[model samples]
Target: MFELKIERVIDAPVAIVWQAWTLHYAEWFVPRPWTLEVIENDLRTGGRSALMMRGPDGEENSSEGVYLEVVPQQRIVSTDALKAGWVPAEPFLVRIDEFAEHAGQTRYTARARHWSAEARDQHAAMGFEPGWNAATDQLEEVVARLKRG
Candidate 1:
């Protein structure tokens, strides 16, 4: 079981940060210039989420997953990316989002668990740092925009 976790202290309230994550921000939550469209986001426990992300190379990646747990503006645990309507994919991926408030700011942590050690190593070597960090940077921007509005 390999674990990859990244956390950032976002300069915003927890609620605003949580909204940016749960809402349809995948349309812009990537390192490259791409778009993410959340086909369906049922935010309740055992609900479903389906997203289609378009890459700069004009590639489209569609993922369908299930919400395993949700604690308001605090935490979200979901299954790995699957086919539409919660169908499991080969070499599945599970995602967890842990949110909290610290010193009046929000702490956003995203963790991913892969099915194999080789997959984990591959993701790490393939630049999960740059990819996720860049995405988080965009996340901060989204939160800032919400605060300004």
Candidate 2:
């Protein structure tokens, strides 16, 4: 197994960052030319977090995951290895997001643990870093706007 971690110190409060992530997720989950549609986002353990990303070319990629843990404004752990109710599925990756207040800003960390090195390599090749980084930038922009208003 391999893991990929990305961190950013966003210029916003932890509360704002958390709200943008948990509530306004669809707004920034995907980059431009790709739109996100949330099917379900129940923020609790064993709840479903399903969504589809529609590309400009009309291609769609859907992902379904179960929330393993949710700590308000602090951390969230989820995985595609299981759906709601702990049902086993084809394992893909475990995603962990952590938020912390740092000098009036939010320190965000996103970690993806793949099932194998091959999977990790594939994700990297698929532009995981750039995609996630752009998504994070979008998240920060949204949060900044929300904070201003």
Candidate 3:
């Protein structure tokens, strides 16, 4: 599998970071100039997280996927965001989020793995890194602000 990974140390606890992934906070971490509309989310293994978000161009993008793995405050794994909950969408992508304590600070990493090199290249060509990193940065900022209060 081909993968893309981004890691950063956020000034927040594990639990605080965990909340950022939930439906409540997800609404904010969505990339700007676009909006997220969550259709359903159970957030557990075998559960679904479906949404139809509109992009800046007024196009609606549908993402329906399931939670493949969930380890509270430690790790999360899920299938391609654009795939149906039951099937492996070709060029399938799996997202994994891992968190650990580093000198009392939370070290978090978000990794995205795709099925093939071409698929990985396509995602990169689509500006995956910049878009996702921006969203993650936004998530970090929100978590920090929430933790401050």
When sorted by lDDT, best at the front, the candidate numbers are 2, 1, 3
Candidate scoring better on TM-score of 2 and 3:
2
Please report, as a residue range, the 10-residue window in candidate 3 with the lowest summed lDDT.
Answer: 82-91
lDDT of each: 0.81, 0.92, 0.78
Question: Per-residue alpha-carbon lDDT of model 2 for 17-78, expressed as tens digits?
Answer: 99899888999989987999999999998899888999999999999989999999999999
User: TM-score order of candidates, best first?
Assistant: 2, 3, 1
lDDT of 3 at 92: 57
Question: For residues 1-149, could you state the per-residue lDDT of candidate 3 as single tens digits?
Answer: 69988898888888887887663545564688878888877677877877787888998987778888888889888875444447655435888989898777789898889878988888899888888888888888778777887
RMSD of each: 2.0, 0.9, 2.1
- How well does each candidate superpose onto the true structure, as a TM-score? 0.88, 0.97, 0.89
> On a 0 to 100 scale, what is the lDDT of residue 141 in model 1?
82
Best candidate (score: lDDT): 2
After superposing all C-alphas onto the true structure, candidate 2 shows an RMSD in angstroms of 0.9
